[model samples]
Target: MSPTVLPAACEVLVIGAGPAGSACARTLAQAGREVLLVDQHEFPREKVCGDGLIPDAHAALRALGVYDEVMDRAFRAQHVRCVAPRGGHVDVPGTLAVLPRRELDDIVCRAAREAGARFAAPWRFVAPLLDGERVVGARLKGPDGEHEVQARWVVLATGASVPPLVAAGVCERRAPSGVALRGYVHHPELAQTLRELQIVWHPRLSGGYGWIFPGPGGVFNVGAGLTGSHATEAGGRASMRDVNLRQMLEAFASVHAPAAELLERGELRGDWKGAPLRCSLGGARWSRPGLLVTGEAAGSTYAFSGEGIGKALETGLLAAAALLEGGDDAAVRARHEAALAGLKPRFALYEKASHVNHRPWLADLVVWRARRSPRILRRMSAVLEERQNPGRLLSWRGITKLMFE
Candidate 1:
């Protein structure tokens, strides 16, 4: 149960109860730190996501000791079907699963609570409590009223919400890296037949892609995401493209026959929802003084695939490790920043591969090559497993090799 009265102080104040915040809280609480995890929403709240768990997410789940619990509830799959605009396709093998954020977030948060972290919800973070330039705590507004809670350290894991980052003075880019629209579809027959996760690239969804991932029961997670919106220009300037995610979803169904069949035959569950994405780790400062940023607030999502859950959890754990190392404020900040920087090169490779989202013909070429080449298929599978960089398959030299060698 949530605490009725807020504590006067704690060792760590973690904002947001998503995967990142929960992971951090659990890690710290398990280490015997006084942790308080708060979120604006209650447990099992609806979250906009693709709900697909790749290999990285699987590894993170194992690290959190929740892999068994999550897999027990997840819809397991072995491969992801990559569909090209010209109808050619390739099945990349990997350990994959799907569990909507509603259930997944609740399970992780519960794990944190089970680890002895104090969990609270429906408590919105108002602003940071400042001691000069250093963050000392936070002002939160709960059901009762606004209250202040002091802490030795603070963590921002708010996930794509800009207001809190702005309030904390860590926000760099105000615009999101991308945007996506998705809704659940209940179709028992379709779910039964669609065993593999399906990702389709089409001319209709230029600069974007659509996905149909089967979930437990008769439900399927259907969505379209556009990452080309916030592309960097020739001189390092970023530009935002005007897009209508709802219309893009419709276009996806119209162009992709499988998506059309699902939409026409399946019953739509709830309403179509949209969410913004921060990709390629390009937004927000990693840390200031006593506070550090993790998860989507630090741009943990990938530009190429829009997958973030794993990286978010990993970054959160990194934050906990930095704090656990027992250092001055500057040392902790430097540690977190260095860890994030190490991941930047991989993020850059994903960004390079995102070019396929804009020119989907490239996917057709890849599918065509993979159909005849066992080596290409192996590399593709390796990419899904995070064993190989996507650039190895999507780069110019890679394209040349695909066509000839």
Candidate 2:
């Protein structure tokens, strides 16, 4: 009998070394899959973010075996102090931990490497290698020119870089809604209040809010998020929106929270970096044939509070599990979607309620009442902690009464 040669290709090829990609690669490699993880940057890369992790995020990291390690290095935020534009403060119950995304990404990537995944950094993925009509792997370009990797499965964790794939007719972005600008800053004076994460809801900024998160040593991460449509609506007056954010935080610190000076000396690390937030509101495809996009690349970030890290980890884990099952491309897609079906309503509700043109009054009222009522504050915290859905706390009926009725 003729000798048979087993295939030499990898079991999985994961692109992007961010939390989602690294988490998926680590999970799959731990399960004994031959995984190759690739990224455009080397370890310790920085990502613009709020730098605070919700309780749910902690739970997700626990499953990946790096939760305890990361938490040890993280600064714990035990309360969420919120400032309102109408002159009130609310301290929501619960704890949010702070750790720079750079540290978190490196930890997760190292975990994946320890679990037997091959690492390919500083290699930009130029395109997916197509076998006729099927995606077999990817082609990457870097200092060494170009190289192709072959794998049974390809997972795209390339947050917001989805346009290149869409242009190549590999993936599609739907309900394309908004853009988000995020940057990192260092403020030493913000240390004493590092125990709490502050979110400011300014009425002047209709669809966006400001955040002040404390990392290790009281370094504050201050940023503002607004919808792209809102920016366009401002018609070159968008700078005024951020201006409102700055002025509001200054006033709040001077009177309500003396720690507001954390933001007073806020310095922009660089020009605001933004990415399009594609919404997966109902009927969005999770995967197609040979490729699967997870995390923000898949539009999995929660639309309401703009939470993505936890959901990205969850979806990444699920995507890895599906690829490990050893099925055809169609079967892999089915498993991925089924795993995420439970979260559809959460994503849908957030996308619906968080529109730039809708429900600003209702949202403000909710925040206002929560500031006045401790019970409401706790409920809001619970919702953010993902102990229960926010829907359970304020129903459509209650929201109506709170705002209008």
Candidate 3:
């Protein structure tokens, strides 16, 4: 069979119309590049997420030019409830935003379109169209027919989805090495009670926390994640859902009656979307080619917080800037790596701290200590807010002062 012919040309072709993809397309298009953004699903597509935009994410949205809309449509809050079974609580207050992925992605896509990006949603990426050794574009299969798009550059923002090129072996898909499950739920009490995001820690789900983020109307987003190693060691004898949620409720119920009741009555919104957590600070081996993978596809998520939105936005911005630098793929890659360097150590430490958190008792103790001490709570809040790195707490002086003073 004859191969499909490539489109005349374009400067950039972006796969996946999520936050990272649309951000890249918008940036490239604003720079006068002929950009084509494609996604398998149409507008208002649903994405599995906590649906809460951390404070850092709010800043990123502003830079992406949709802060106003996001603010208008999102749930405004000022604190995160950290409930750990070890028996203490930490309440850190700061401005945060929550909006369903549907609305958030739609707003970003529309902004990309308004910025001159041509979008082709409901278009499946069949494969990457390579020019010699360089990734030039992609072969897309849509309702109309199969077509090839040739471009000077390609941005793979397919998130967890394997891009055709990656699936075809031209690039490697970095497996999470850790598994996670996220879902939505609805309950009037959960909705009214959850004025802010809640993070519940249980001993059964070490290295992962169950999260409940309020959604539109009276719904809530709830989910859990656990390291694959821990999950396996837990015997693989039963399901994580039962083990984790049970642990979650036990730790949260008495202190948070509303949360407990919501769990008892709330309907799990949709099918659980399970995926692996990619904690690759070394970046992807295949990302150095003309093709670049941003967001979770590149494993840029912070292992500790599961906060990918900010890093994804930052990576997309870096990709756009690197492309504008007029350098080869290696040059673009170096810049990308350098951009993420500052965030690597903090993420690594987060992962370490997170693992120690398996003992909800320990987490509760720390939270309890923090609650009793205002200064400690302030410092901890600073760490959670990303104002101070957790690794900084490793210093002897810092550790002693935090514990004693």
**Cα lDDT computed for each candidate against the true fold:** 0.92, 0.69, 0.70
Candidate 1 lDDT over 1-405, as tens digits, reads 454578889999999999999999999999999999999998989999999999999999999999999999999999999999988899999999999999999999999999999988788999999999999999999888888999999999999998998999998887788999999999998776889899999988999999999998879999999996776778667777877888898899888887898889999999999999998888899999989999999999999999999999999999999999988998999999999999999999999999999999999999999999888899999998888999989998889988888
In candidate 3, the residue pairs with backbone N, CA or C atoms under 3 Å apart (3 or more residues apart, or in different chains) clash, namely 86-360, 86-361, 86-364, 87-364, 88-364, 88-368, 184-269
Candidate 1 residues lying further than 4 Å off, grouped into runs, are: 1-4, 231-240
Candidate 1 matches the true fold with a TM-score of 0.97
Candidate 3 is scored at a TM of 0.86
Angstrom error at residue 151, model 1: 0.6
Cα distance off (Å), candidate 1, residue 102: 0.4
Task: Give the per-residue lDDT of model 2 (tens digit) for 1-405.
Answer: 001211236878888888889999999999988988888888888786666788778888999999989989998877887666565667787757888888988999999999999887777778877888778887776675777778778888877565545633545433234555555656655565455787766555556666777777656666655543323233333222343434433443554343345434655465555555545432235676688878777776766666678887878888888888867778888888788786788776666556522344455577777866776777777777776656544557657655553
lDDT of 3 by residue, 1-405 (tens): 112233456888888888888888898888888888888888988886667787677877888888999888888878888877654567877777778889999999889999999887677888777677777777788777888777878888877654453653434433453556666668875576678887877665565666777877778776665653222224334233333534534444444555567667878667767665555443354364668777667666666667677667777777787788777778876776666666667668766555444555656656767788886677667876778756555344545555676
380: Cα error in model 3, Å: 2.2
Residue 396, model 1, lDDT: 86
What's the ranking of the predictions by lDDT, best on top? 1, 3, 2
For each predicted model, how many residue pairs clash, with residues at least 3 apart or on different chains?
Answer: 0, 1, 7
Error of 1 at 126 (Å): 1.3
- Stretches off by above 4 angstroms in model 2 are 1-8, 167-170, 174-176, 228-260, 266-272, 279-284, 355-364, 371-374, 392-396, 401-405
